[model samples]
Target chain A: EHPLWEQIGRSFVHHYYQQFDLDRNQLGTLYSDTSCLTWEGQPFQGKAAIMEKIASLPFQKIQHSITAEDHQPAPDTCVLSMVVGQLKVDDDPVMGFHQLFLLKNDNDKWICTNDMFRLALHNFC
Target chain B: EHPLWEQIGRSFVHHYYQQFDLDRNQLGTLYSDTSCLTWEGQPFQGKAAIMEKIASLPFQKIQHSITAEDHQPAPDTCVLSMVVGQLKVDDDPVMGFHQLFLLKNDNDKWICTNDMFRLALHNFC
Candidate 1:
């Protein structure tokens, strides 16, 4: 597995667990300023804004199991698709949602520039 | 411009005009049964079902301009991305939304197998 993949996995886990213990600044540094995140049809732009929005969600605990992942890399751009299995609040298995992450390589690190996802509520109910 | 491109452009225009005057059945035949469409936040499956759902919408007039088009063709699959400018009902020029169409070549023709889009409402409002 690539080191960046491991980092992404850990970041997601940390965020899901609301373990705000991790350095929040790292999230902004890892994602690009132009990044667009659409969750359940709600749009949030930039890493700092998205971080604040997510932090505001009233979730006690959360976990995600990545079911499938596909990554395509070009010289400067990377497209990633993953099926995520989410467990939240009432311990309900929120089926799975598809997430497409578009990343651009800056210097030597990958920073997400576009993030699109379908929510469980939109898919199941 | 490719012949297939012209056909797609025409089909979209015909459907948008509420030219329910056009062959409605052709819509079903043009799209694959497994195609997925998400409008706003609601998800719909299959061409037949999607057509039905669209027909039920209370729209007086609709028009779309293709702002951008990108097509990548493999031996068996074609991926298309389009930015569509929509004009609907109240004569408002809705900002464009991105639509991704995944098509599989069957026999000699192409049919959409996966259709993913960010609706105007989801993107602008």
Candidate 2:
């Protein structure tokens, strides 16, 4: 395990949720204009499209409790992070979730190139 | 898009479903014994664990129609494939799904090292 890669993964997870909760606009800096997000099977390309999808979420507030995570440094300074967590959406039942991120190290800064998120419900939530 | 990688992705998607439908036993050959799988959030490690999880699925039969896919060749001869598709499970409502595979090219043979699968549904279905 690459310690530095794992550190980046942890920081990304922490900062993403914090920024998202404080102000989603702040989270835009974490992603590039060309970044893409896969929400289950639907695709959202570009930060503008990603923000639109984020804003359309059914819940007004959400919390993420990361339980397990792993990271792998890929070629071309790319990093793959897999996170397993519990999601609390407003007052709803705590939901299980899995998120994968492909990050690119650009100018000593890490930027998310691709993100994928899905619920853990067997029946799908 | 890497043409060869994309071709591999397509073949992997096709054969995975075909073999899974015919005989789950055949599917085990595609994954290494130490392979890991993330179903939404929960984790399944090792081929035995993965097969157990697959066998426990509620659906007796399932069909996968891959609609979109992307493949990136990573370091260490690993290929990352992201797939978006529609799933039909024993006459259940057609479900949208996203699957990610981290495959390692071992002597020209692609073996899945990490697999993730999730269904797309807004509410618990």
Candidate 3:
């Protein structure tokens, strides 16, 4: 295990959410052409498709408040992170959510390879 | 993308939860010496340590009901799966949780290389 895996993972997650809350348009820079994302059961592949899906989200304003997070180093040297948090969208009440991200190093820069998000509500499905 | 990744991912997840709910003792066989798990923010490496943690859970009776699941084949050919669901413990009310797994093929058999789990309760932490 790399001694810096935890630190790198934590910092990457912080940067990700910060960018997401501030301006989702900048989120695309954190992904690459080979990236994939599953948002609320919908799947999108590649940078363009993923960015399109993100930009099309129905919510106008969103803020993520992380309650807990876990990180691990995969055998392939990628960082696997799971984040448990609450989010406020527009004027709606706060809702809980779970998100997972697999980040890999590409030319000395960390980029997300896979991402999955789901709302943590009993009746949401 | 592998044509059978989704099917394989779904089957693997079904088998995993089935064994977990029916008899966690059998769960050890699904992991390998290099497998890693993070349960409720605690990290455990290798199969023996992971199994020890799983067997030490305080709950006597537990059941999981999955509401949604997402799967994607990573660039390294590993299957990344994220599950959102509810669980019942003893006489406690159903509580939402999120679990993630990365399954890799080894010697013609799929084994869980990484696992992360967390409860989705507000005010619990």
Candidate 4:
């Protein structure tokens, strides 16, 4: 709710997606040992496990176009962010996706502590 | 990450949707003055304002069918839950939706501290 939350949240989201699209391997800088990620209902914990799953994402080329996003400050100096966006993989058609991230400041740098991601499909896949 | 988070998250989601579908007015019991909600990019703070928005939702009858959900324990004993689901409003076609809630215990009762909601449409609306 504070103005600082908006600044922090926007900056974090920008850095996250930019790094994700450019080089997902660099995303490890945004997580730590206690980080947890739920990608399409599959849960992965810790930086190593999460990075392994991210690196094996099945696609070589991808781009994300964000449609809308909301950010709020949560308890304990954490920022909660939700994103609705479209992603293009290889030659595949653009697919809608929704993601949420809970970020906390560690050593003055924002690190993702929790993440949830899914393709916005009508039926569960 | 913790088993208790799953239990608490599942229970909270069940009660939340049931109350939402049955009587949205009763949904206020899950919020407080410090709560915040971002409903489709529109931000509302506190119980009174949030309830006003909920009460004015354009549809009289609605039914939600959850497709998938994920829950994890966050900092400071908070539970973060994300839900992917479909909802039918009145006689309209079913629409996909994604929502996230940050739940924390206050006086032994779980209260929603932050909520984000959006309908899964390809284009931002």
Q: How high is each candidate's TM-score?
A: 0.42, 0.60, 0.93, 0.95
lDDT, candidate 3, B1-125, per-residue tens = 64588887888888988888898878988899988899988899999999999999988888988889899987578999998888888998877778899999988888999999887755222
Native interface contact recovery, all models: 0.00, 0.10, 0.38, 0.40
Candidate 1: tens digits of C-alpha lDDT, residues A1-125? 55464355344433533433333334666566666666654667778788886677676655545543433221123433333334434466554444555445568766666555554332211
Interface RMSD of every predicted model, in angstroms: 12.0, 6.5, 3.9, 4.0
Tens digits of per-residue lDDT, candidate 4, B1-125, equal: 55999889989988999899999988998999989999999999999999999999999999987889899989899999999898989999888888899999999999999999988765432
Under CAPRI classification, how is model 4 graded?
A: acceptable
For B46-87, candidate 2 gives per-residue lDDT tens digits of: 888998888887878877787666665544556667766678
* Candidate 3, A1-125: lDDT as tens digits: 54587888889889988888899988988899889899988889999999999888899899998899899888678989999888989999888878899989998999999999887765322
Question: Candidate 1 — number of clashing residue pairs?
Answer: 0
Better of 1 and 4 by DockQ: 4
Positional deviation of B11 in candidate 4, in angstroms?
1.0
Residue runs of model 1 more than 4 Å from their true location after superposition:
A1-26, A74-76, A90-95, A123-125, B1-125
B30, model 4: CA deviation in Å?
0.2
Candidates 3 and 4 compared by TM-score, better number: 4
- The whole-model lDDT of each prediction reads 0.49, 0.73, 0.86, 0.90
Residue ranges of candidate 3 with Cα displaced over 4 Å: A123-125, B123-125
